[model samples]
Target: MTSNLTDNTLDLDQAITSIKIWDQIRDAAQKSLRSEPVLEKMAHHIVLSSKDMAQGLGRLLSHQQPDTLVSREELEELFSFVAERAPQIITFAAADLEAVCERDPAATDFFVPFLYFKGFHAIQMHRFAYWLWQNGRQDMALFLQNRSSVLYGVDIHPAAKLGKRIVFDHATGIVIGETAVVEDDVSLFHGVTLGGTGKERKDRHPKVRQGAMVGAGSILLGNIEIGHHARVAAGSVVLKDVRAHATAAGSPAKEVRG
Candidate 1:
């Protein structure tokens, strides 16, 4: 039997009927169905059979989640519920796919991230978990958070705030603490950490502003601000605020070029 989308999803389906991204994915799926016989069944099940972007994405992500704890059908239902309620997630998810294709040279098209990239998968999972966390469904949210960590090797707290067009390049070993706030257009490389420094409870994580780029293996501790367009060099341990357009490096990261 087929699943049914809620009113909002149906409305959103109509709203995005002409959006190019959906057309791109559908076209790509059709091509893969014709060219790659091995993936034809999978592609048809995930993309061709679906009516819209949200439903297709929900099925795709849900296909990756769950290892006997929950069925794919159950996760798909939960994801559908999240999208119906928080339609901005659909917008952010589309922006995320665009960001990867635009920023990562290795990513060639929407089809790549939509089908294979773990970073893209992990981020969408967090968006759903974050929504659950916000709407008083913390237990289920944390369950999804754990699934994301185990599946993708990227751990972002359900309470951590994220923004649009965020790119996590080679995102393995990334950790975002409970209070961390990563703003729009931010790019974080593999092994990057937005972590707490000490024992004190409130607002302990770093706030990465819009257009900031944190390099691979870098760690930003405490509640410091990494300003707009700022750059944190690879392997640095930032302990202070980095002003806009500055580049921070070294163990106790200092502003090298402002």
Candidate 2:
């Protein structure tokens, strides 16, 4: 019984530590809503009334629809389905929100990214779409991808694998291919493309390892690997593997001494 109590305490501590930032964000949102009467309806619907992060995010994403192809009800149902089916979606979102607050100087609070940042919105939408893809709902995934591209100007393939703590700064015009894999703590700026050289399919996109920083307007082609902690300079065209901790620049990017 003593051992069970200790284990329970440790589990509770771990869970609280994991959601520390999320709790902070929720508290901040509530305070802000209280002070700003204009935001009462929107804030209450998106955050205050929400039971948890999953429900809050579901409502937020579902409300972004323009009522064309998918109605607000349909969008909400889809988001709720994904959130319930895969709880990891909320986990990734929390990490992502924390990442934006830590990495972007412009981000003042979690509510900023949760409400206004299209880059953050695009990534979360992709998470839902990716869940659909994994569950053999490819058509629905494609539909969400198309909607995300139209709304956010960021086109990430539904099948692409993404890790935690990724910051897509100014995510407009960012395109990631179907087979591309982005590891944790990676930062990508606007106009970055992880693409293939030719029409050949089958494992043809770039693999970006952990802690890499990809600059704006850069194009990385083929099945090349960008090693961990490497930096690719802006407007560079990379065609080869970049060694870990190295800096690659210029067209057909070559390693520059870091």
Candidate 3:
């Protein structure tokens, strides 16, 4: 009886066609984004990320998924997830940019990418790896992290906890150490190092609290908290806690302003 029924009317191809499956799926995704402001914003980020990944993959392989490979349905799903997490990512990205502006007046010109320019395949991968690390999938996170660094020349450790609105301007030679904590609204300039003091076992890296900006070529080492709204001057080596709204300069940074 079962074989007879299957032979009589089981048509998987036709069933998919009858539903207008792909078309309906695409339309539904678009509808959800259009209906919700939050979803729409998230969709923008997701689309950017997807495009970046597609471009990166194309560069790494001889055979590549066409730039147009991202279907509307897939893009919608990506945006939906981004919408749910937009508050966090947006906050971090902002903090990062604010930090850059504090360090250099001209920083805005370069840091603009994190705000509007999308094509940072490496940045998207870093975000994904960081998410994996938070979920306790360290191996996969590390694998992605290494891959991103090898391909893009940017090495941000997955274990680093970054707050919302973080910016990495002119993003070359930037190294974010493990155990480093970047709070909201932080911006890091090129050649910035949030590093440790010679492999010390205990929390041996800088903690950039909210609204902190580390200038270009700065080396902030050891376990120290850069207080809220603090600025680490260019080429400085910071080794101590900087009070909130203060500015630090020189090696073993000294408080310059408040």
- Model 2, C-alpha of 111: deviation from truth (Å): 1.7
Quote each prediction's TM-score: 0.92, 0.90, 0.59
Q: lDDT score, residue 241, model 1? A: 96
The TM-score-based order of candidates, best leading, equals: 1, 2, 3
Report clash pairs, candidate 1.
none
Model 3 lDDT per residue over 1-258, tens place: 001110223345533442342233234445657776675654444332333322212222211112345444443344334324422332233333344445545544322332233223344455556756776779866866775566556788987776545666666778888888877667777788889989599688888988788899999888889998899998999888999999999997999999
Q: Can you list the residue pairs that collide in candidate 2?
A: none
Off by over 4 Å in 3: 1-123
The local distance difference test score of model 2 is 0.84
For model 1, what is the C-alpha lDDT against the true structure?
0.86
Q: Measured by TM-score, how close is model 2 to the native structure?
A: 0.90
For model 3, state the Cα shift of residue 151 in Å.
2.9
Model 2 per-residue lDDT tens digits across residues 127-209: 88887888899999999899899989999999998886789999999999999988888999999999999966899999999
- What would the per-residue lDDT of candidate 1 be over residues 213-257, giving only the tens digit for each residue? 999999999999999999999999999999999999999889889
